[model samples]
Target chain A: MADKKKKKLTPEAQQYQSYQEKREVKRPIFKNCIKAFFVGGTICLIGQAISTFYIYYFDFTEQTAGNPTVATLIFITMFLTGFGVYDRIGQFAGAGSAVPVTGFGNAVVASAIEHRTEGFVLGVGSNMLKLAGPVIVYGVFSAFVVALIKTILIKWGGL
Target chain B: MLVGHQTWMFKNKPTIISTGTVGGPFEANGRIANDIDILHDDMWIKQDSFEKAQRTMMEEACQIALKKTDVEKEQVQFFISGDLINQITPSTFTGKTLDIPYFGLFSACATSMESLALASSIVNSGGANYILSGTSSHNAAAERQFRYPTEYGGQKPPTAQWTVTGAGCALLANKGTGPVVTSATIGKVVDMGITDRLIWEEQWPQQQ
Candidate 1:
């Protein structure tokens, strides 16, 4: 059905709906906000620490360290997902864990782990991207579009 | 092995005299809360670990059945119970407390029905007057074993089942006012080509 029709009032159905609404517990928005802030901030802090470490140890410029720092974060998240620790953090932190690139890495690795039973080709290769595919597609396409716009502005508008 | 699809046909009808059930807070908040004999406030059951909590529920369920019919612990011949824990420790520990002749079983979710079938066959054949058959699965304990830890907050796919943290036990005897078990059939293992773990987990329960 495209849309559910408005049905005639049944006394029992009305009573049941009312009961369900009454029993529903309200979500604590403030607590959730606090949790998300702390967890997301912690992830960013760790990323900054990694970037700083790379700049100092590898003698890299602040500009060059960004790529390696992201790789490191994703690497760390993948391992944590494998070891079954990232999921715990994800649970405790909710959106805090999800907003970071690490969460994306966790999602990809978690799906791979889940589908490992179906063999490498069909299971790991195919299903690994099942959850991560859409995000990646949009990311690449948007980046391409931005680059195209930049080129068009530089060419036609004469810088 | 001389067995060829061997099935047990009992001469006497085994009756479920009394049943005892215990559930976690999740089930207590569920629609069928009133149906459960005992609804626990928390999953831990005042125990230190999830494993121990599962054991307490299992033992409590048997105790409830025994208490309802005024049957002494010593009078009940067997404690055929199991839980979704490593080595079936909950059943083992509960058996230790009951001090009854135990047959610790492990058939995952099917343990409840399997144990009932086994107990009914034994009772019908004059093995014992009363036997307690029970099985339990703590959501935390099961998630820790078969999947990730409960604290992990891992998002499960739609096919993933919520492991019900509850224990249910029934005392089967030759005469009782409850439902009677006329016959029992042991199942054979059949594997289909369903490759997904979540799908497999969901399918196994439905098959039973």
Candidate 2:
């Protein structure tokens, strides 16, 4: 795609683009992946511990412990976001912090606090889902599509 | 007046008679804190919104510049300023408070220098006797406009710039006993066909 776009540029612009490309900073994708793996794994480990705790301490079974565990993680994330610590963690962890339920919590809480000055109804309430709204919309849509495919396979394609 | 294709050689040599610099807590903790005339303990500067805070800081910087030279607000003929905000509202509000004939510029990171250049050119050409040249930028306000909210969790590349929460202004005059502006060169836009907002990879030591 980039090459296709580059072909349309003027000779001077193309030359400059190539020159810039040589000097451009390459993203440390390998390092980021490693960091994300460890950090994301650690977050999942904590979530598992929370789930186990709910299962063992409370009367809840393994099947019913997921909701409380997610809520707990989000609550923790809300505190971290309010204290301005989660942003720093996010800077270090990249997608590790982002691709988790905690990240969604941070998005809502951060936007809420950020636009509070504009008033509650217009500012905090409306803009609260600005960042997380897309994630929710698409997440549910993708799940629905997957569920539809599963139902079609079960109903039409004999087991 | 016109020196080269993009340069201007000022004959009058407009002088920066006085200057005022305001900074937030982050800048206050920096090495050049001593040079800052007014350093606020908080980023908000007691304003309700970050935009309002930015405006207040700009006004404070302009006021300090005027006070240092004992120049009356009426004496300053022109106020040239800019910022990174959408529509440069902080600078406009500062102009409204200073109540001077205003010229709002938008040069992003180069706003301060651009304003100074224009202010000097105007004073040098006898278009204005006194000019206040300055720029203000709040980190939060700039982030809200250009990037994300202050509390948003996102990783920025090493080359990403931090929008400083501060304001600085210089009182330039046609005749004074201080640093003189001799020339000004306006920049030209050069597009390199690169659409990536984030660029500039760090060259390793081995490469160097």
Candidate 3:
């Protein structure tokens, strides 16, 4: 789709593009994927530990502990964002830091802190969701669509 | 005067009398820290915002540039500077504080050299007695505008370059005992037609 959208370029631009391609340094995809896997797994391990702590001490079941677990992750992410460490982790881990619930928390909190100079109402309140707003919107919409499909199939097609 | 299609050869020989460079804590710890005029341990530099901090750095750089020379602020005829920000606010605010005739330029990374060339041309042609040419940028301010927020968890590729959080100014005069600006060649914009920023991310890393 992207390739199709590209407009025709002049001969000079084409020559420059080819030259840039030749000189451009490449990214280590395999190494990045390994790093992402380990980092992502570590985040999940920490999340599981939080969930287990709640289950063992607070008398919460595995199903009920998920909410508090997610909340704990986000709270930790808030601290990381505040201390200016998460961005570095993000640069190193790439999808590892970004594919977790903490990444979502970072998204909202980072924008909020970044816009703090503009004031609370116009700055923090309005621009807080600038990055993560689309994710929430599409997420809810897709969930609703999936639920609708499930309901129709269960009622008519007998599962 | 224009010597060729793009180059300008200055016959009057505009000279750089003095220079001032103010850097952030990151640069203060770097290898060239000794070369910087003023080093601020804090990224904020005691300012309320990153933009304001950038303006403060520019102001300090300009002041230091003047203080290093026999020239006074009133003697400076033009202030040419710019930064990577919305509407180039940092440069404008610095000009406001200096109260000098300002020319806010925007050439992305080339802003410093562009301002210097323009200032040299003006001084060479006897258009101004003294011109302060400078440019500034803050990492947080630039990241917020060009990429993600300062605290955002979005990853930057290995090929990504860090923006320098500092300001530098040069005092150019027609008559001075310093290095002279003989000629300047301005470059034109070129579009390579590669719009995908993630193409670099797709390539396999080469072994060192």
Candidate 4:
């Protein structure tokens, strides 16, 4: 049986071997890097622009300007979420845009839209806070604990 | 975060004059003043799971304000705050914790700024002394009413903002020892008439 297995390959096997000879192509490294650099840089530039706008137009001090900038970004992201443009940006920017406050707005609006078909009150209204609920809960809870400690200290501790 | 509190010195102790909220009907208290105290107490709206958190944050902010100033919680003449939640839970909870003469307000996101303005005016006019004014927002609660939840992986637009999931409190003393609220400006709501709900496009533009 072992000697018999050494026979020459049939023509059918040779034909199959020839079919698998296609070459694999590689993407240009420079092009990929250039694209990444521009896209990433553009996001940073937008953030800078927002900060400047708040400072110059709103008369906000440098420190306080961050609030307005975040507000503006949120507003923009909300509109985009409604128009269905933000999802694409998220894909490209990865966490660049999603890590900010604007990302939170996008999550809320998008989820609302997803559940809108369920009806106004039950669908959209009920599901609206699904994504942002934790932030509110934790934010409030943390603050409450702080207040409790402060109250105790002021009331009895005399600090 | 600063865990400890510090006291400031002044020749005369500053008194809390007034406190107010924006998202409610105004009462006629005709008085003039040079400076006003305002707190952004109404900025956060409440939702079901967020009730406990809102109360907690309001209490913390108020505590910070009280601890920083010499006034005791009982000595506080009034506590003013508001939100868009049912019965104004944030403000109500805050009132219960502080256990002072309290007023609830509602004005959506503008609550905090509006409250600060009112507090400033009261302090300048000598209505009361040592007023505690503050505002808070919980992302979870506000999103439930206004948007969506965290489990959803839905896309977001560039314009939307993650509501600050935190609370801020300030002490309003008439003596002008600490940083005094200088002015409060009210902003009117404006709609840009954007009918396109799907403003953010879901696809990235392909590189040409």
DockQ for each candidate? 0.08, 0.39, 0.48, 0.04
Clashing pairs in 1: A88-B152
**Interface RMSD per candidate (angstroms):** 12.9, 8.8, 7.1, 17.1
lDDT (10s digit) by residue, model 2, range B1-208: 9986999998998999999999999999999999999999988888899999999999999999889887799998999999988889999998988899999999888999999999988888799999999999998887877676678777776556788989999999999889999999999877777663532122100110
The deviation in Å at residue B194 for candidate 1 is 2.0
Which wins on lDDT, candidate 2 or candidate 4?
Answer: 2
- lDDT of candidate 2 at residue B79, scale 0 to 100: 95
lDDT of 2 at B35: 96
Which is superior by DockQ, 1 or 2?
Answer: 2
Best by TM-score: 3
Q: TM-score: which is higher, 3 or 4?
A: 3
Q: Candidate 3's residue-wise lDDT over A74-149, tens digit each?
A: 9999999999999999888888888889888898999999999999999999999987887788788989999999
lDDT of 2 at B151: 84
CA RMSD of all predictions: 12.2, 4.9, 4.1, 29.4
TM-score, candidate number 3: 0.91
Better of 1 and 4 by TM-score: 1
TM-score of each: 0.59, 0.90, 0.91, 0.43
Better of 2 and 3 by TM-score: 3
Error of 4 at A137 (Å): 32
In terms of docking quality, model 2 is acceptable
The digit string of per-residue lDDT tens for model 1 on A85-146 reads: 98878767767887788877776787777556557899779978755666778778989999
